[model samples]
Target: MNSKHQILVIGAGTGGLMMASRLKKEHKDFDIAIIDPAKTHYYQPAWTLVGAGTYDFEDTAKPMADLIPKGVKWYQDKVTAMDPDSNSVSTEKSGEIKYDYLVVSPGLTYDMSLVPGLSEAIDKGNVCSNYTDPKHTLEVLKNFKGGTALFTQPTTPIKCGGAPQKIMYLAEAYFKKHGLKDKTNVVFATNGTVIFAVPEIKETLMKIVDRKNINLKFYHALKRIDAEKQIAWYELAPEAYEHNPAKLEIEKEGNMVGIHYDMLHLAPPSVAPEFVRKSKLANAEGWLDVDHHSLQHNKYPNVFGLGDVAALPTAKTGAAIRKQVPVVLDNIEKLMKNQAADNKKYNGYSSCPLVTEYGKMVLAEFDYDNKFTPDPELKKMLIFDSSKEHWRLWILKKYGLPYLYWNKMLKGQDV
Candidate 1:
């Protein structure tokens, strides 16, 4: 109603809500507002479990109304334009709202058009994607008769870098459970050159790949899919194209390898939201241009960005956001206090709980250098080595993280 605020946050996803709730707890006197049209906030990390039928879909979501921090005015409308130069944002119905500081964590959107037939093939027939609808993926898995069970990801960045593979591992377990493992060929064809970046984690995953007999076709990017013909064509990576022709099986069609599949699950190409991509705050890559260490905008001192929307070198994950939020908060508080250039730095820390199989998980925690830096606290108190498959890690994924997210992170509690 005031058409103004001291600080305004965009999006109501993980990063946006976390920042807002904590700001509320610390700066109760500051007039803050958040703009988002979402009715329900989802714990998307659990969808990997949901797709495997290991977790309930309903448990992954909560009404957004219950989560947005109290006293932080909520604008239940989408942002049409973000004019940071003018220090104002235009909403679809609320007209213009001004802010002294803007927090952009609107997250990314699926660019289904990246691959020609991706829009038509996703969630259609044998093609299923947990990113779009985990429930639909479950149904697709239920009716899977058995053959080539292939999983792949887009060349572009996607939230949860390991998500595409997480489902593959879980689905493999499903196949083994229903006596279809013998008849099915499990394959992961990714554009990434390695199974995982961290060495210890990669070693752990490589073992799982061997045990499950899952195929890993690195340097293979999905080019297109012929839904009617049950064919998924792939373009070989540069290494395969110019150097190693043996990278692809010679028996397959030349140039583009067209593989036949019974089921295809993939992470589609994703980009910053249209509103963020088109805004002045976005980088050339269409993501918010923020300092990798401070989580502050490169050009604007009063503007901050985080979550999947920020163009940071680390993986776009909720775990990364956990480290980023505090840095953003500290910098914002310093600015509010007229403290110049005094800021906190994020070490680009992010964690990915790689669920190798049912009752088994490998925690991959690292910094900017791709070092296998386990959480010092966890390494000392919890399990010693995070890279090894631990049943306790599986419990953390299934129960611990979700409980912490809803109770601690969003509620502005440190623990």
Candidate 2:
């Protein structure tokens, strides 16, 4: 049935679910609906701990039916396309649905095929990724008998930029626990030059890298995975660049390097869902064309977005969704009241709980310019250190944050 509503959220993800929950609670009269085909919602942040054997895999998931707001209708359908000019979206199972206001938060998709042989090898051999399957990663980590272990971060933006290394740190700690540290040669390969974007946090992560005695290979982006050979191929990021509109001019030859590994964990390239990229509502870079501040669509005022699918120049993480939820709701409320949404602005706040070890983490929080913006209450409770590894922060990550996410954030309660 082709239906119309006051608000239609395209995905029942963190951003979409949180937005619906808040709106339904705040403005009870608004007819809001969320569409997603998935039957389970995952607490992805906990997957890192799950991969490390600290958290349970079963604990990382909840039935989507349990998490959807009580009043908002759920459309168990996949979105196929959007007609933003007419405020309607097409779905694979449910056909076309129109809305007065739309929230586009379908999130992102992983391109494991971006690297040759990765798709065939992942979650099958000693090769695994916490991103794709935490259970397999747990298996990989548990079976390690010491040797060359390499953790890789792709050239494209990933869900949590720190995830590639978070598992590396945990695996290192695991090696120590299993008496395999001395024999294991741990390596972290990334396309970026620094461990982190924020200088303060980068400095601390650098120290952790040094203390762990892990090899850091900068400008290395995964290009191929020869699982049969137990070798990984990478291309060195080119130094010179030509401002080609379509493709980059690079010297592709002589830049490839191959490394053998006993075990490997990789963060594959991620991009906005294919539907969002192909839609007219997307920005030049194939993300939702929303204002980075207001979380509102620049061209279509009735459309708003927040999450990995949105074109915000910040790290994509669930923590960012916590801050972004309120901003988007406030602006939507403003729109409801016929008031300008100019004052309601999001400063691109995002966070990465850098788990340095089994019991220590550096809670890195920052705003638009990558400035560390600590929460006053958390700072006071955590002794105001967001860049240093602390047990309290680890506790927050392991136990506290997940509780807050399920009990508060999903219920529209501010953390």
Candidate 3:
């Protein structure tokens, strides 16, 4: 069915749902329709907590129909193609749908093929990923017999840059809880040299790492996994050791390191959806190419993007979208009225609640420059310093954030 809307939003995710909810609240008369095929919308941020066995997986989701804001139309259809030049999109069930303005925020997807054996090994034995199957992560952690427990992330950008480490910290805490701490060799093999981009947060995480005695193997990118053999192979980046990326015959001769593990938890490599990647809206990296500040398409002003789909040089997070939604909504209003921006630019603000242990957390907030800028309002009301691990922050993470997400953010209240 061919249809046209004043504002067409893709994906009822944090970006799409919030955009529709906020806009509908202010501009009730506007014709807005959101497209998403899913029946349930999952709060992915809480998956880390689920993997740690603290939060129930079922609590992380709700009926998408329940969350769709009143007065906003919802289309249970998947986006197969996006055509910004024509200001239209093609859906799986629906035919070509035209729009005056398009909001492209179809979130990223994971491809286990990016890493060998990742798909086959998922949830079968000790191999588990919080992003894919968080429930199985809980099982893996519970069944751990205490050996080398390796946690790693791919080089490709994944949902919430801190997620990989969050699960790592939680798994370590779980091991400690089960009295497996002494027998377990907790190794964090990450592609990055630093614990975190933000300096203050990095310092805090480092302290936690030292206290837990977790070994940090810097610049180690997960290349492949032999799940059957219970071995994970990693490729070492040359910059870390001042060598070159080389592959010879064996692990000792090459830049590869294989570690056998009794338990392995990993964050799978993820990328933008194929439809957005092949479209004209995509950047060189296959993500929606939008102005980082305005969240407007670089080439098409009628288009806006946010959330994990946007190719911004920052973490893909719901916290980032909280800041981005206002900028996008403000700009959309201005463009409709005068086709000009009112200095409403996003500062690339994203916050990650790094759960160091079962009871402590560090609220790592930062901007485009990786500056550790804590929320002044939070500091004034809650904790003054977010650089240190605090039980109060953990309480906020486990309870407060989810409340704000559903009742405040999705319910069309200012967050």
Clashing pairs in 2: none
lDDT of each: 0.87, 0.86, 0.87
For residue 89, what is the lDDT in candidate 3? 97
| Models ranked on lDDT | 1, 3, 2
TM-score per candidate: 0.95, 0.95, 0.96
Q: RMSD in angstroms, candidate 2?
A: 4.9
Predicted candidate 1 versus true structure: per-residue lDDT over 109-155, tens digit per residue: 89989888889889877899999999889998999998888899989
Please give the TM-score that candidate 3 achieves against the real structure: 0.96
Sort the candidates on TM-score, descending order. 3, 1, 2
Model 2 residue 315 CA deviation in Å: 0.2
Q: How many backbone clashes does candidate 1 have?
A: 0
Candidate 2 on 254-307: residue-level lDDT in tens? Answer: 878777888999987788998899998898888889888888898899999989
Q: List the residue pairs that clash in candidate 3.
A: none
Error of 1 at 140 (Å): 1.5
Worst 10 residues of 2 by lDDT: 241-250
Off by over 4 Å in 2: 238-253, 380-382
How much lDDT does candidate 1 score?
0.87
Please list the residue runs of candidate 3 whose C-alpha ends up more than 4 Å from where it truly belongs after superposition.
241-253, 342-344
